[model samples]
Target: MLNHEVYHKFAPNQQYSYALSYRRQNVYDEKAPYHNEGVEQEFRLYGRYAYTFKLSERWKWKNTLRQEFRKFLLQTFTRQKRIFSLEPD
Candidate 1:
């Protein structure tokens, strides 16, 4: 899995410019076809800010804030075990 996004503005401050995001996930085996082998490599970074105060430009109301964090897949998947045992001899 791979995703990338980019947005930049700093010459005139287009609503307080700032945007950059990236994603990556890798795992080997299991038929191996979804970008196999890297054993999960995730790196997330996000920072966004927007402000608009016009109240008369055709109805204005804009406010945005974002913050993200994640450094490589740490693995988290647990909840599947419904009893399966029968051996008494």
Candidate 2:
């Protein structure tokens, strides 16, 4: 597997980041016993954005958003995967 990441700070307490990664699976002769099907590669990309604010002397608010994209094998073919999430405090 290989990964690459980048991060940027928008403020002292806020930042955004993303990552790219790739993974591979190997099938040996004992596993698949096929000459043409021996390896498979999968790739994924995702990012996150976060911000924090002071709400009170003893309290604070934080929010985050995340998104991801990927491809995976299904029954007989590959399919795209997309995900998104948001968190607040």
Candidate 3:
């Protein structure tokens, strides 16, 4: 699935603001031996932050930071093979 996200700041003097996000499931292959695009899943999230500081009346400095996370769940088609990802990074 795809999602559209937005954020807003209400305070006038709010030089610092932040937002968070979350999601689940990624790349769940549920196809047969014929390789059918029956069902698949994936998830991703990202966050960003910024801070404003004034060095002079006309000059201001802005610093920003960002972070993100991604997850995927790939299920096996056969009963013998186990289902799971090695690292969820």
Candidate 4:
């Protein structure tokens, strides 16, 4: 497994970030009974954006949005999954 991430702050209460990751799973093993004789490798990428505001002296508001994408490699049939998330305050 390998992972890398990058982040930036546009303002005191605002920020943006990105992440990349790679993983390999042994879908089949020679010693296993059910063996497909193949391995599955997944590559994932993620991005996020967030901002916050001071609503009051003791109150704060925040919003965040994130997205993710995945790709499969070294597989007979390539598959991918995508996800999105949002948070508001």
Candidate 5:
């Protein structure tokens, strides 16, 4: 598996931030019981936004929202549509 992310602070006070990320994964198996002949590849793209605020002198509060797009492929690099999905938080 491999992943990469980049983050930026958009607010001057550092209260707001955003990030973009990408991830890749590979699965290997000795038998072909399902799709991809037991070997599969996955890729993910993510976008995130965050806001931070002070709740007290010694404590801080933060909220984050993330969105993800996922893609799956067979060993032959053929795209798989049955497992496609989106996630939001």
Candidate 6:
């Protein structure tokens, strides 16, 4: 698997930020049941927003919201499935 991301800070105080990322994965198995002789591929695109604040002089709190778009493919690159997800942390 491989991933790359770019991030931007929206506030000079660094309280707000956003990022965009891309990921790719390759799977291999000899005894699996799906996708081109047990080999599969996946690709993903992600976007995230984050906010941070001070909880105390020595502590901080952060929250993040993320969205993902993903696709699965056979080893030959034929599309198999598409998925979308939203997550908060």
RMSD of each: 16.5, 7.9, 8.1, 6.8, 4.4, 4.5
Q: Alpha carbon lDDT of residue 78, candidate 3?
A: 31
Kindly list the per-residue Cα lDDT of model 3 for residues 19-61, writing each as its tens digit: 3333333333466554443333434465556666778899988
- lDDT of all predictions, in order shown? 0.48, 0.70, 0.48, 0.76, 0.65, 0.61
The TM-score measured for candidate 3 stands at 0.34
40-88 per-residue lDDT for model 1 (tens digits): 4444555667665567848867677666554544234222232221221
Model 4: per-residue Cα lDDT over 1-48, one tens digit each: 999989899899999999998888777665858767676777778898
How far out, in Å, is residue 5 in model 1? 2.7
Q: Runs in model 2 with CA error above 4 Å? A: 26-38, 52-63, 73-89
Shift of residue 45 alpha carbon in model 3, Å: 1.5
> If both were scored by TM-score, which would come out higher, candidate 1 or candidate 5?
5
Q: How would you order the candidates by lDDT, starting with the best?
A: 4, 2, 5, 6, 1, 3
Q: Which RMSD does model 2 reach against the true structure?
A: 7.9
Error of 3 at 34 (Å): 29
Give RMSD (Å) of candidate 3 vs. truth. Answer: 8.1
The reply for model 3, stretches above 4 Å from the true place, is 1-5, 10-43, 71-89
lDDT of 2 by residue, 1-89 (tens): 89898999988889999998776776456455555444555567889899989889899898989787765543334543432223221
C-alpha lDDT of residue 88 in model 4: 23
Q: Per-residue lDDT of 7-32 in model 5, one digit per residue for the tens?
A: 78878434333343444445545577
**Alpha carbon deviation, residue 23, candidate 6 (Å):** 5.9
Badly placed stretches (over 4 Å) of model 4 are: 28-37, 52-63, 75-89
Q: How many clashes show up per model? A: 0, 0, 3, 0, 0, 0
